[model samples]
Target: MKKQDTLSPYIHFDRKDWAELRSSTPLTIDEDDIKELKGLNDELNIEEIVDIYLPISRLLHLHASATRELYESRNVFLQTNVKKVPYIIGIAGSVAVGKSTMARVLKALISKWPNHPKVDLLTTDGFLYPNEVLKERGLMEKKGFPESYDIAELLHILSDLKSGKGRVEAPVYSHITYNIVPSRTQVINRPDILIVEGINVLQPPKNGGGKEIDQISVSDFFDFSIYVDADEKTIFQWYIERFKLLRGTAFRNPQSYFKKYAHISDEEAFQVAESIWNRINKVNLRENILPTRHRADLILRKGEHHFVESIKMRKI
Candidate 1:
């Protein structure tokens, strides 16, 4: 029981009432028309997305339009400011927490909007340091950890995009290889809206004035940010289930880096999956990842079934 004089604001959105808060503006694209997204951890069907994500996309479309008008006005205000880049949106969350699904959902929904219909989705997995660098630094166990990434390169990409660099290239990662493939890159050419999603995209800036001072995080370039929220147990279960699924699917491919897991029995696979989660992913999630949740503009909280049950937006 605290005093009523506290200035802290209380705001909440009910899962049952999500429909009530939806923008009256009709959805230009039918949810049924949107393709189903297949992710390792979750299956987001068209209906679930239309009810939950379509409205959110509608909001973002409005946001992008308003932002463009403001940017044009500012550009005119400063004749010397010649180039204005795409509005960058950052989505961050723990492993197997459905951030990737959110990115896919938003990308599909936003692309249908009449304004800035061209939407591009990019993942920070491309920004990771090569496997050789991780092995050399003995950081193979800390792969998803912040230090495992080439922050400098990631920053350069974001900076270039924000500065209206018409042609941008991002490294491409092959899930089967579990590594960044050299000479294979994704091209982004003058995209109207860009979505950058990752686990540690929102990590705080480094304080040291060395090589890190110039390293701008993906979050620094984002105009809007979202952080998906869920309890540790739920996310842990999701991670395990996802790992099991991959063992039979992607892990069975001869070219897969995890192909070794295919030989293990179900019990052995489960143990191996839990071992990796306990050692690497869980540590990073609890220490370096979850701490950044407060930095998001909007937080989407999910329940045990992996369904988003509530939303918390930082009070303006």
Candidate 2:
């Protein structure tokens, strides 16, 4: 264990120490279940889940339990029935850093708890502006950048969810088509738990007209948030690997927007992938995503092999 420095709000733990905190948390997921939860080219297994994620699930369960108690207490004091709002959890990270896999695993594990049996997973990819809009705005090449998202609509949905809306709908995005699917929507019912995952979920509100309004950012609605961290060099490697894997799989589909890459040679594909990463994703990570990491309630730091090495959790 590393010694904590004074004035730091985070308590740090190495992987071995963190795994011991699992205590009596049971592993509810099996091998077959993990296969369905893992992202493309991601390395995940039962051991990692038991050591890394089981403890997280337990922590979330505790948080959710406490929140419900608090809400009930408030209602009793007011002597009125108040609607129970969903507990929102945000997962943010650089592209190809496995935020999607983490979100999926948490959704499955946390939903199994008796207290919050209803869980829903939502990704911000669906909230990105349609390709036509991006092209019209001349932001087609900056797809993953914060400016490429429909920020106002995303805020409206979160606000509605937090206000205890019975039903809310979000647009559906398709990687094969590389655009928002026409007329398709994901219906979010009133769930006990909601996981919102994306690269820019933690971004601070931008100042409009040289003045800051008292408006709430998307992250302000979150009861808990996590940031997945990895070195820039290693993440670049994972991005390239995922691109190659997709070329052999999803990109080969005739309807896929990236189908053109499937016909290219390995060398050509690598060059293209590298170019895209250097020109777009890398810049977005450094300038936007990485800067917001410190705002997370929990930070899962990964090592070279895509395994989590340590965790830094906010103590206050």
The candidate scoring highest on TM-score is: 2
Which regions of candidate 2 fall more than 4 Å away from where they truly are? 209-214
Scored against the true structure, residue 123 in model 2 reaches a CA lDDT of 95
- At residue 253, what lDDT does model 2 achieve? 94
Instruction: Extract clashing residue pairs from model 1.
Output: none
Please report the candidate that would top lDDT against the real structure.
2
lDDT per residue, candidate 2, 20-45, as tens digits?
Answer: 88889988889999999999988899
Task: Give all TM-scores, in the order shown.
Answer: 0.92, 0.96
Q: Clashing residue pairs, candidate 2?
A: none
User: On residues 1-316, what C-alpha lDDT tens digit does candidate 1 reach at each position?
Assistant: 1112235332456665554555564555454544455476675655556556755676677677788888888888886565758878899999999998889778876776655467889999988888998999999999999989888888888888888799889999888999999999999988888999999988988766466545456688898888988999889889888888887799889999999997788788779988999999999999999999889887888888777877766565
Error of 1 at 254 (Å): 0.8
Q: Give RMSD to native, each candidate.
A: 3.0, 1.5
Error (Å) of candidate 2 at residue 159 is: 1.0
lDDT of each: 0.80, 0.91
